[model samples]
Target chain A: MIIQTEALRREFLVGTRLRRRRVTAVEDVTLTVARGEAVGFLGPNGAGKSTTIKMLTGVLVPTSGRARVCGLDPVRERRELARRIGVVFGQRSQLWWDLPLVESFDLHGAIHRVPAARYRERLDECVELLDMGGFLRTPVRQLSLGQRMRGEVTAALLHSPELLVLDEPTIGLDLTSKERLRSFLSEVNARGDVTLLLTTHDLPDVERLCRRVVVIDQGRVLVDDELAVLRQQFAGHRTLVVELMEPAPPLLGLTGVVDVTVEAQGLRQRLEFAPGATTAAELIAAVARHVELRDVSVFEPSIEDLVRTIYLR
Target chain B: MLAPYPQLMVAGYRRYASYRQATLAGLATNVVFGLLRAAVLAAVVTQRGTVAGYDLPASITYVWLGQGLITVVMLWGDQELARRVRTGDVVIDLGRPWDLQAAMLATDLGRAGHAVALRLLPPAAFGALLFPFRWPERPTTWVLFAASVGLAVVVSFGIRFLLNASAFWLLDVRGVIAVWGVVGGVLSGLVLPLAWFPAWAQAVLRWTPFPALFQSPIDVFTERGDAVGVLATQLVWAVLLLLAGRTVLARGAGRLVVQGG
Candidate 1:
């Protein structure tokens, strides 16, 4: 396993001195990631996702339990583990702000002890892969956010680490930049040389790059399974909205339809149904029989909806 | 293990070198302050002909050297680490493979190097051209003074590192930094030569590392007192302060209450 944790937990002492309380940030986070597996760790804000990543990365020692990254204890053998794993916290930049982007990469290479030739080769590869050649000489403070993030990723990978961990790598990125980064990450993962562990609120990033998904909330894992399995398990409901030719009563008593809402002065009606129990075509046909449909639209369950369902469960 | 530190130092050097405006502005401020301080100290020395074994030229040298070394030792206004701690960016520092204390020291040495060239040299040159400056008579005094300044950087870094590490618990170190700004200036003899202080006050300040930071280097440059003994005291303080800094940093990291969650 490239990463493993058994009963991992961390707590923080908070509040004023007279009324301090221990708040559990992460509790019993038993998880394992095999080499070359791309997993997306998902959670809402303040869901202990960052806290877990911190412990795993050796930034914060766990209050209890065990964590091993690259077969070394994170706290005891932090420097060794740092050499074997790459990390990019999206909210922070490891690059030197005053220097050119390439200089930061060079410094990172030196810090990780990547030999000169390998460092040059890897730098070239990352520069090409991330398409960062144009602004390689630009100081980090001058680059756009997207460009700086690209530089950060390149710096992290210059050492060719075994596992790559990113927290919200695509946060606040424009649509085009987000898509480009996701595609580049997918290409990296497809090589099967680097294990990927990412935490992001952008579900499409997970959908495109991760085969496995782990959702946690309230300091506990709510679901851990393949992305496809997760969707099937929690995302059972699909909505079908139909615009009828005239006002009609709410479409009820339909097979597999769990709920219905009438809107637009009864001209539009939304029918929520279990896709496994009834196919969209069957439901659409049944709805067509009841009314003369002017327009029809079927909405697939999004990862956001699936996670929301998991949280509610 | 040792290879990266030199490169980190170079990185640190380049990081500061890029800020041309800030360097120029700081040099200007140093020169301006050096003139004001030289005027005050020269008056005292000219009236008494010499005070506490310092002639007019020696006292003027003290003022300019203190101005230059103030930036080199970086007695105050360095809140980089504390700010990083408050922002929780120190996690990046902790996550790296290098020892945090050593890395900071190496980087600071680079910054001191830059200060020596831009901040230290120009003011001393200005003092020599404009005032009666005391030039070190012995070549060995020059070497010893260099050693003293370097040790002073290390010692100052140790103190600053401890001050910054407090942010791990305090979350905001502005008040701490404010207090240090006043205390460091006076205690380190940046305000006036330690020799000018009464015998008892000098005795007490000698026991602290503050004099090793500012006073020892100036004393060495002026070839005042026993140069070897002054350098030895500065060396002792450097070792002790660095050890204390390392211990405090490790303990702080152990309980590291990272701010901003």
Candidate 2:
């Protein structure tokens, strides 16, 4: 395995003088990711995703248990392991704020001891792939958020590390910027040379890039499954809305329908049902039998909805 | 192999040198302080003719040299490491392959180099024209003074590194820095020469690392003490502080709390 952990755990001492408590940020997080696989680590706030990443990256030593990245102990052989991995924390920039974007790239190359020729070749690839040529000479602090993020990614990859760990890489990006970055990541992953570990709240990022996801909450892994399976199992709820020509009758007590509600003085009604238990045709016919439907719409559970369902459960 | 050391230094030099306005403001302040200090010392020397072997010209030289070395020694508000620790940027720093203490030392060297050119030399040159500056008579004094100043940077880096590492445990480090500034200023001879102190106080300060930071270097520049002995003391303190700083850093890393997400 390129990444492996066994019974990994971390605890923090929190609170004030009179009362202090030991809070376990991550507990028994035994996980493994093979080379060249992109996995999404999903969680709600305070779910310990960042804590795990910190241990793997050697930023925080694990309070207990073991973690090995690229076959090196993260704490004991941190510097050696650093040469084999690249990390980008989305909330912070690794670039020199006062220097041009290219200068940061060159410095990263030097820090990692990349050969001069390889440095140039890899840098050229990153500049082209990220479309950063226009602002290569601009200082990092002056770039737009999207522009700076692209620069950050390029800097991380200049050393051609085997694994790339990104935590919320698209957190504050606009829609167009998000699309651009998503495409760039897709292109990078297509090479199948770098293992990708991404932790994010953006559902679309998981849908497009990750085939498998590990969901955690309250410092424990709740689900670890393929994205398709997750959608099938937890994303079973569907919504149906209807506008009637006149006052509507109750559409409740229908087979497979979980809940129903009337609105606008009976002019409209909303029905919720399990997609797996009832076909849209069967539900629509049941509603038609009860009310004169002027218009109708059906909504499938989105990735966001699925995640919310899982969290609520 | 000195991997990535030069790269970090170059980055630091570029970073500090890019702030043109701050450099100009700092130089102005140093020059002003140099003038006020020279006038005060000149008055004292005129009254006593000599105090602790410092005559009018020698006292004026010492004051200007202290102003010039103010930025070189970097005795205050080096909160960059503390800020980084508080903001979680230290995680990014630790994830790098380079040794943290060595990288920090290299960066300080770069900042000191820029300070020598823009902050130190200009004030001293201007003070020479305005005051009775006593130029060093021997070339060996100049060489030894340079050595002493370099060692002083190393010693200062060690102290700053230890202070900055306290951020691992203490979230708010401003108070620590304030206390360090006051104590370091008085004890390092930045406020005044150790020679001006009582005999016992001078002897005690000489044995501590603080005097090696400001007093020993200034003494070498003024030829007040034996050059070889002073320079040797500085070298010893530099090595000792280097070891002490490294030990603190390693211990701090074990308990590091990168404060923010």
Candidate 3:
């Protein structure tokens, strides 16, 4: 296993001195990620995702439990583990703000003790793979956000760590930049040399890059399974919207239809049904029998909606 | 194994070298302050012909050297670590493989190097050209003075690191920094030579490691009492302070409460 945790937990002491209290940030979270597996860690805001990453990265020692990254204790052997893993915090820039982008990479290489020839070769590879050649000479403060994030990723990978962990790597990125980063990451995962653990709110990033998904909320894992399996398990309901020719009563009490709501002065009606119990064609046919349909649309559940359902559950 | 320190030093030097406008502005401020302090000290020395073993020339040298070394030793106004702590960016520092204390020291040494060239030399040169400056008589004294200044930088970094690391717990260090700004300037002899203080006060300050920061280097440059002994004291303080800084850092990191999580 590239990463493993048993009964991992962390707590924080917060508030004023007189009324201080301990708040659990992560509790009894057991996880194991094998080498070369790409897993997406999903959660709502303040769900302890970043805290767990911090503990695993040796930034914060856990209040209790055990964590081993690259077969070394994360806190006690942090320096050794640092050599075997790469990390990029999306909101933080590790580059020297005043120096050219390449200088930061050089410093990172030196810090990690990558030999001169190996450093050069890896730099060239990352520069080409991430398409960062044009702005290599520009100072980091002058680069656009997208360009800077690419530089961060390149810096993290210069040492060729065994596992790559990213937190919100695509946050606040434009659509084109987001797609570009996602594709580059997919290529890296496909190489089978690096294990990927990412935490992000962008479900599409997970959909495009991760085969496994772990969903957490309020400091506990709600679901852990393959992305496809999770989707199929929660793919409970599909929405069918139809625009009728004239006003009609709500499409209530229909077979396999769980709920219906009338909209647009009864000209439009949405029917929610279990896909296994009744197919979209069957629902459309049943709605068509009630009234002459002017338009019809079927909506499949998106990953975001599916996760929301899980959270609610 | 030791490769990264030199690389980090170069990075630190380049990092500060890019701030051309800030450097010029800071140099100008140093020179202005040097002139004001020189005028005040020169007046006192001229009236008494010499005070506490310092003649007019030596007192003038003290003022200019203090002004120059203020930036070198970074007596005040450095809250980079504290700010990073408040913003939770120090997590990045902790995550890296290098020892945090050693890395900061190397970077600070690089910054001090830049200050010596741009901030220290220009003002001291200006003082020599424009005032009665006391030049070191021997080449060995010059070397000793250089070593003293370097130790002073390390000692100052040690103290600054401790103050900033408090942010890991305090989460806001402005008040702490404010107190250090005032106390550091006065006790480090930046306001006036420690020799001018009362005998009892001088004896007390001697044990506190503050004089090793500014007084020892300036005293070495001026060929004042016991140059080797003064350098030895500064060296001891440098080592002690650095050790203390490392201990404090480890404790702080143990209970690190990263803000904005």
Candidate 4:
């Protein structure tokens, strides 16, 4: 694995001095991400996603247990781990605010100690891949959020790090920018050299960019598996809605179908079936037999539902 | 395992120069203070003619030079480590490839250098127009002034770095920074020369690190070379403060919960 944590925990001090309180921000999280794997980190508000990312990227030291990024302990060998990882915090920017985008890139390249030749090549690739050439000379404060985010993405990649850790990467982007970033992430993952650990509330991002996912809540891992497997496990079953020309008869005990619930509209009934046992066509046929059916449609529960379940648990 | 130091310093220095507004504002504020100090000295000299070590001319000269060098010495306040830690920006900083304490010190030094150079000249010229005082009679004092100023900067940064690191443990950082600002201002002689203080008080103030930061170097312009020993004492204090700052940072980071990460 490129990144691994064993029962990692972080505790915070809060409230007044006279009334001090300790809060557990992260607790007993054990996870592993293999090299070259693109994994999604999914959770709701206050689910400890950001805290886990901070520990993995070597920003926050764990209060208990241990973590290793690229086989180096982040707390003991931070500089070494820094060379191997690229991080982007969605809420904040790393750019020199008054300087041009290009200047900030040069500054970061220097900080990472990328040799001049390699720096130039990597920066050029970033400019090309992220479509940042148009705004290279503009000050960061002058760019729109989308343009600045592209610059941020390019800056983080200037050193060609082995792993990229993104916290809420698509949080506030518009639909178009979000789609573009998602496509870019997918392409990067497909290239097969860089691994990614993307934390986001956008379920489509997980569906589009990552083949595997790690879901956590209150500092604990709820699910970590291939996207397909997770979908099978907690995604529940697909629902089939049939529109009947007349009142639908009760199909209380069907062979393939699991449940038959009456739609609140009174004109249609909905049927649910497990995967593989009944195809959409078979479900449609099964439902049509109980009614003077006009039409039928099948709907699979989304990954959003699966993640919501994990987070709520 | 450390990268080249000079290259890093140069990069940091250029970065500070890139902030146009802050530099311009610093120069403006320094010149205004220079005018105020020069006016007071001019009024005093018009009445009594000469006082202790400074005549009317010498006092005005002192005010102008000290005003201009405020940025050079960063006498206004220390805003580095404390601000970062309080805002949670330190979360990003602590993870960087460079040592947090060293990197912050280097960057602040860069900012101070720019502020000093930009702010120093105009105030001195303006002060000369307002009052008469002798410039360094010999070129060697100029060389000595440069060395004194470098050490002064080191001592200032070292002390401020320690004070700023206090925020890592304290809840109300502003109150601490405010107290440090008031003490550093008075003791560094930003309000007036330490030479003007009473015998017993001057004796006590001279022993502390404050005089080396501002008073000793300001003395160079007037050829008061007798206090080179005092600047040496400040250099010693600088080393001690540097060690103390590092220890504080190490402990603070280990205990940091890094709430927002």
Which candidate number has the best TM-score? 1
Stretches of candidate 3 off by over 4 Å are A238-273, A277-299
User: Chain B vs. true chain B: TM-score for each candidate?
Assistant: 0.97, 0.96, 0.97, 0.90
Q: For each candidate, what is the lDDT?
A: 0.90, 0.87, 0.90, 0.78
Q: State the displacement of the C-alpha of residue B225, model 3, in Å, after optimal TM-score superposition.
A: 1.4
Name the better of 1 and 4 by lDDT: 1
What TM-scores do the predictions have?
A: 0.92, 0.91, 0.92, 0.89
Pairs of residues at least 3 apart in sequence or in different chains that clash in candidate 1: none
On residues A1-313, what C-alpha lDDT tens digit does candidate 1 reach at each position?
9889998999998899999999998977999999999999998988899999889988899999999999999888888888988999899989999999988887888889998988988889888888999999999999999999998888888888899999999989999999989998899889999999999999999999999999898788888999988777889689999999999999899999999999999999999998788988999999999899999999989988888888889
At residue A125, give the lDDT of candidate 1: 86
Total clashes for model 3:
0
Provide the lDDT at A199 for model 3: 97
Better of 1 and 4 by DockQ: 1
DockQ of 2: 0.49
User: What RMSD value applies to candidate 3?
Assistant: 3.5
Clashes of each: 0, 0, 0, 0
Instruction: State, as a TM-score between 0 and 1, how close model 3 is to the true structure.
Output: 0.92
For B1-261, candidate 1 gives per-residue lDDT tens digits of: 237899889888888899999999999999988888898888888898889889999999999989999889999888998899889898899889998889889899999999999999999999988999899999899899999999999999989998998887788899999999988999999998888899999999989999989999999999889999988998898899889888888877888766665
**Clashing pairs for predicted structure model 4, backbone only:** none
Runs in model 1 lying further than 4 Å from the true structure: A239-273, A278-299
Residues B25-136, candidate 3: write the lDDT tens digits: 9999999988888888888889989898999889989999888888899988889999998899988998899998999999999999999999999999999999988999
| CAPRI verdict (incorrect, acceptable, medium, high) for model 4 | acceptable
